[model samples]
Target: MTTAPHAETFHSDGTPDASGRRVGVLLSHGFTGSPASIVPWGRYLAEQGYAVAVPRLPGHGTTWQDMTTTRYDDYYAEIEREFDALRARTDVVVVGGLSMGGCLVLQLAERRADQVAGVVLVNPAVNSTNKQLLLLPVMKHLVKAFPGIGSDIKKEGVVESAYDKTPLKPLASMVAAWKQVRAGLGEVTAPVLLFRSAEDHVVDPSSARIILDGIASADVTERVLAESYHVATLDNDAPQIFAESAEFVARVTSQVAAS
Candidate 1:
């Protein structure tokens, strides 16, 4: 199967800081999706001189069938590797992601609260209100996959480079990770900026509500994307996500510097 060109990993060699410590941002894509979904946002951060890493999660950027072989631990391992690399090189690190990517970053924030500078999430998916997901444990044993939940963009004619099918086993693993992360939300103390699309088909508003209500971060900001859907990073309100994320990194890092 031929993958879309945008699905490839993106990297930007932003200028190093004068103080010999870099400022970096790590952007992760959603489940069954590649970096293509968030490349524009990463590019925006790169242009502002923040070293950006958008790694293709394991089992993604290839094919849906390939994703079936991987589990959520493998996906989080990729993000953790990227996070460690950035933490070593940068003085302050800001973590951001799209959907499952957002959940992964929250896990990272919970584990590395002392190192993470800030957090940015666009339509983050932590929990689903859909009752059908409750049957995943049993259904995954009989069914191998389900219809894809990708490309939920409100903008016309735009397509997200994501898997056409959702692998039930991997999805079950993802849901388990979501539960683990959600339970630890109170441990995340970094400044957070969240962008929730008003009409998302894939992730329910409860995901955002749970995050906002659970996280202990006192500096939490939520902006509703009026013109987008689940993939707001690539939808009509993408510019808002890009601009606000850049501003968020700058603001939080400066605050750290001052403190």
Candidate 2:
């Protein structure tokens, strides 16, 4: 695995939200996305008097060249380390992620149940095959050779760049990560707040259904972002994401009091 140089940094315009024993929230962006995707959500939560961190994964925010050298363990390890940091800063840490980042958070909640107070997943890619959609692992290999999807497939509430070039190797890595997380789904017992886009074409919608059906968390609540697509964090549904997530954090924080 290629080890990239680590430059640690934290900059938030809002004051600490964990004052007076409040909860902290950690936001993670999807694969191929930098903290930029979760910046809006982090800022919104921070402004509401909550400490938030949107960590930059190793090799990310640098270049596709750097990402090409990293492995799935490298990605998952960085998130686990960051989640620990967030936990140290506050009494309760509510974790959330977008897309593959969502899968990372779910994996964390399963194993570190005591540390994570709650979860919010936006357009999570839990299972590769959702919506009766067949994403042949073989297709990724094929796309590696011929990486053009022809035209930009337009969806509501967002504009997709349409990664015409599929790096089959990267596809294989992400799938591996998903498989590990999927196996650990039963372990993530924290109450989860799930969001799905009715129009998302990237990740399978069935991914959400599997979580809803099996997770031990009794307080799971799901909302459909009817107005948006896969990248709901950037689309019109962003406001709804902010509002609902803020509420979910508050709900979990109250649990601390009850206990």
Candidate 3:
């Protein structure tokens, strides 16, 4: 499938603060979704003087067929590469994401605790109560894809640019990565701000429960998006996410500087 123009990656050259220190924010989109899913959030941070990078995952922003050839490791490697690049240019880095992007950033926070100053997640999926996911190991061999989980937004006229089908093999890989990330949640020390939609259709609330209960970070906050669904970043509560995230970045970076 031809990639939509809006699905392209987004990057911003951040300006340094008065102290000559630069702050970078890396935003990751969910599985089968492109940078378009989180561009507004990234742009809001960039406008607030933070450098932002929203990269298209290796197999995303293209076609479901392309995503079939990729794995969770490929997605993680892409985020890792973007994180290193942002860290090289800035003094403080804040990472955040939606859905699977949230899982990837949590993994980064676990491994690079010293470099990651803060994290923001929207409807993060660490564990799921969905029984169908359990059969992925076997279903992947029999089925090439499943129904799409994209555009789970409550707001009218807003649609997410994502795949029409969920590729099975890559999804199995994602499930494996989710297990690994959940096991290592205790290693994350960075401050966290999480948003959960009260009525999500794709990811169950259990995913949010696991994240809130497992992460070792003492500085964690959770908010409910009452007016949205799974893709709250583009739904009715998007403004709340954008505003709160900008504040979260500022607060954490300021605290880091004072320390």
Best by TM-score: 3
Ranking by lDDT: 3, 1, 2
TM-score of each: 0.96, 0.83, 0.98
lDDT string, candidate 1, 1-259, tens digits? 5656778888776776665656899999999889989898898889989989999998898888888889999998999999998877778899999999999999999999998999999989899999999999999999999999999998999989788899999999999888899999999999999999989999999999999999999999999999998999999999988988889998898899889
Candidate 3 residue-wise lDDT, 1-259, digit = tens? 6766988888999899988899999999999999888999998889989999999998898889989999999999999999999998899999999999999999999999998999999999888888888999999999999989999999999999889999999999999888899999899999999999999998898888888888889899999999999999999999999999999999999889999
Candidate 2 lDDT, 1-259, residue by residue in tens: 4322322333353344333675678888766556766777888888887878888876565555555566667767888988787777777888999887888888889889877889999988778654222454666545542342211223443433333343455656777667677777888788899999888767777789877876788789999888777778877788999998998898888787579
Q: Compared to the true structure, candidate 3 yields what TM-score?
A: 0.98
For residue 178, what is the lDDT in candidate 2? 75
Model 3 stretches with alpha carbons more than 4 Å out = none
Q: In candidate 3, which residue pairs clash?
A: none
Which clashing pairs does model 1 show? none
Model 2 misplaced regions, further than 4 Å? 1-19, 130-166
Residue 235 lDDT in model 2? 79
Stretches of candidate 1 off by over 4 Å are 1-4, 17-21
Indicate the residue-level lDDT of 80 in model 1.
Answer: 95
Winner on TM-score (1 vs 3): 3
Q: For every candidate structure, what is the RMSD over all alpha carbons to the true structure, in angstroms? A: 1.4, 4.4, 1.0
lDDT at residue 252 of model 3 (Cα atoms): 96
